[model samples]
Target: MTHTTHTTRTTGHVAAPRPDVYRALLDPAAIPRWRVPAGMSCRVHTFEPHEGGAFRVSLTYDDPASTSGKSTARTDTYHGRFTRLVPDGEVVEEMEFETEDPAFQGLMTITTTLTDAPGGGTDVSVLHTGLPEAVAPADNETGMRMALDNLARLLEHPG
Candidate 1:
């Protein structure tokens, strides 16, 4: 079957405990730091880390010329609800782009799961599904990878 929408999964291991990793993912202040893509900045307008809670965020590209199918210009805004949250285990959010563009018509769910690594640390897997037709799966994977890398760094070496 031919797929029309994008879906991506990225995995990584962080040299930190699951509780620590979970806190960073759900923390309002830390969310903007690690969730942003490598060349972009994330602004959190509102965040409440609990099931049925809502959050709003905007990501702006560093290069104003850069354009994604979801955003013709610079910034892409989103508002989503926390569908599920499990302490030190998992988080699921149902999100929708805040735009009238056809590409941003559907709701997307992002799930992040955490588990203990074989030797130590924590294993994190992120799955993003229901991406619109305009978004590319490869790009999403790359961005997720970057975010995971940042999470590793942030957890292993706190400033």
Candidate 2:
């Protein structure tokens, strides 16, 4: 019965306005497109992008054998509620895994801030807190970086 609190932060620069970046974060279509790390795909089961709203997301690994080690399936499902939201400013949410594993128990919070950069670009950064000890810090950093990179790519070059 061990408990730990960890935090991981990653930032990206996009040639877009804060509103656009904020929209993409809460948009169902855009979330799955950029929120996942390499070799992983995201599926938004349900999303209500507002304060006090809830969301359900599934992250599936490309490889059948790939798993979070705490979840039984290759696809880990998480459900949480939006704790707070400030348009063109910040988004905050809290989530917990749906696994029976002890290591994956407890809640985690993710806060993303969108601000105006010096050149009209948007500075987006996400801070994930309360990460369980089951997940390594290095892995979390790499995964978060990948997700941010994807977000930047999509926001910088949108159709």
Candidate 3:
């Protein structure tokens, strides 16, 4: 089993916000808002924000006729157990994606850490492990960056 790993980090200017606000990231309702670019949409089939809960989301480009909207760009149907939830500070999720696609079929764990900065902002770091060699490092890096960017935007403007 070839193993690969990826790590990404992002820092926001605003204070670390509330733990509850960070926790909102796991919610299905809030996922679509930040899972992708503003024009894309996300649909969650199951999202239980707790230890051993399962989560799945389908990210679809809004314009079906557009080149980007040929099909669901990605359907993350994965099972994960929240190994640890440190309120606003950190979340460690152990997950495995079920896929026949050679590029992304493997067991993976993602640990997301949030630290409070001096200006009440938060610094987020994500460490991904157990990726298959078939998956490119750049792709993971780009995806994580987009996801974190989305999270930052969501926290900045709460509904």
Candidate 4:
């Protein structure tokens, strides 16, 4: 068997300031609202908003027919820690999936950078490294895009 490490990078613009965007990134209460992809939900079981702080979260597919769950039949669970946090500039996390499949066992590093856009809003860039071979690059990009979209909506129109 061959070992491979995949990487994915995605960027977007949110109609919000860097501080507000940064707050949304670390706030546990805001996680479930913005960190989830479409057709799924996020449940943050454990969260600590600081460097070296650990967090555990589960994403459950809304449709029972979805078979893409890495941890269980319909849920993808992972636990990791905040390796680095740079105020309103960046957030870095190291995480891995809870799965019995050998193809999905590995540590993934996610680095999210926030900056001011040229025109307006905040420029968000997310880089994912060390993705497992079982996860398609297209799927990962799609999920990240969806999550970014969700974050934008939450920050731009907070009711």
Q: Could you say which candidate leads in TM-score?
A: 4
The models' CA-based lDDT, in order, is 0.89, 0.86, 0.64, 0.96
| Residue 85 CA displacement from its true place in model 3, Å | 1.4
- Which ten-residue region of model 3 has the weakest summed lDDT? 67-76
Tens-place lDDT digits, model 3, residues 35-131: 6644556777778877667776565555656543212243445556677777777777776665666556666777777777666777777777775
Off by over 4 Å in 2: none
Highest lDDT against the true fold, candidate: 4
Give the TM-score comparing model 4 with the true structure, all chains together. Answer: 0.97
| Model 3 regions more than 4 Å off | 1-20, 37-40, 61-76
What TM-score number comes out for model 1? 0.93
Count of backbone collisions in candidate 3? 4
lDDT tens digits, residues 37-140, model 2?
Answer: 89988889999998999999988888887755355568778899999999999999999988887777789999999889996889888898998777787788
The number of clashing residue pairs in model 2 is 0
What global local distance difference test value does model 1 have? 0.89
Clashes of 4: 0
Q: Is candidate 2 or 4 superior in TM-score?
A: 4
Candidate 1 lDDT by residue in tens digits, 36-144: 8888898899999999999998899888778662544788888999999999999999998877777666889999999999999999999998988877788888988
